[model samples]
Target: MKTSRILAAALLAVGSGLALHAANAQQAGLHRTDLLQQDIGLPGREAIQVRVDFDGGAVSIKHSHPGEEVAYVLEGSLEYQLEGRAPVTLNAGEALFIPAGVAHVARNVGSGKASELATYIVEKGSPLVVPAE
Candidate 1:
């Protein structure tokens, strides 16, 4: 079970009420931009994660998620894995989907640096990684 823990837990307090870690702001960035998250869990966000990577290489295979995932190749290629299935290869403009609670692995697989964008949507408080499998 391999994974990366982003955070423990979060909570937000408003005018007359308190919200249980419901994100904080709207985020946007480019390649050289570090994974900037203004409000990691923007309020009213039903659960959405967007990742854009550029010139990616020398990467490791990591699995972290217990919910559905949709990925789009912005450039180059990507190699990924999911529980009970073989590895998959995706090129630029390509897309893939991952089921909930599935164990998966991913890395850049193209000869040159790879790039991609991924969006994961789920319930609030849901962990991005569930201790792998």
Candidate 2:
């Protein structure tokens, strides 16, 4: 009985620590600002622009979008990895294009805040992004 109680307590402590870590990660995750969005006169398609800021150690999980994405680095640097391709480091003034439906992840690998301007050509009614399974 004593051993079981000790195991329970240990589990509870680890669970609490994991909860705290998740909360902190959420606080330090990506910050995005919508810059522009407009219809391009194509049925169900729109052009959207956004600025994404990543704090140090920030990382985005594998995800995919329904449309083409183009990102331009605005400050600092990041590592972008697309499915089946080697990860590439992108610095300020550099740009990358991701074809629609490709899984990818991005991480801020610099010591300071990193930012990028992202433009998407996507269907108007679809989710802008979705996590990959």
Candidate 3:
């Protein structure tokens, strides 16, 4: 009887361990993914972050996972200033790339409110704006 009880206990322990493993796997854990900046409502989208700073630049930020971000100046010219790099200017139908984790800011140098559209494919669970000092 003692031997049978010991065998049953061992089985129960193993079963519990498997249950825990399965539970952990079922939890929401982000992985490498391709995220379009637009919110087209396709599927499996975590978040779609789009911002339009009309002729007004915001505080430049950095990130952890490093992203490949590209911007298209739609309305007017944009002066993109980056850390440790020369400032670049782009006009309508022009585009620029901001490398991963590099501090950068954009300003509309052209008259009127300049508009630009940027898209990014970021690693899952990583924020769009990772603060940089």
RMSD in angstroms, candidate 3? 14.2
Q: What does candidate 2's lDDT look like per residue over 1-133, in tens digits?
A: 9999999989876875565355335544788777887899888999989888998988986788879999999999999999999999999999999999999999999999999999999987566666688
Model 3 weakest 10-residue run by lDDT:
26-35
Where does candidate 2 clash, by residue pair?
none
lDDT against the true structure, each candidate: 0.56, 0.85, 0.57
Cα lDDT tens digits for candidate 3, 7-116: 99898768755653543333222111223444335343333334344534422222222366777777767788788889898888998877767777666677666666
* Deviation in Å, model 1, residue 107 alpha carbon: 1.3
Which segments of candidate 1 are over 4 A away from where they belong? 1-45, 54-56
Candidate 3 lDDT score at position 35: 31
Which residue runs of candidate 3 sit more than 4 Å off their true CA positions? 1-51, 56-65
- Model 1, poorest ten-residue lDDT window? 19-28
Which candidate number would show the highest lDDT if scored against the true structure?
Answer: 2
lDDT of 1 by residue, 29-68 (tens): 1232224223345463344555655344544334555456
Q: State residue 114's C-alpha deviation in candidate 3, in Å.
A: 0.8
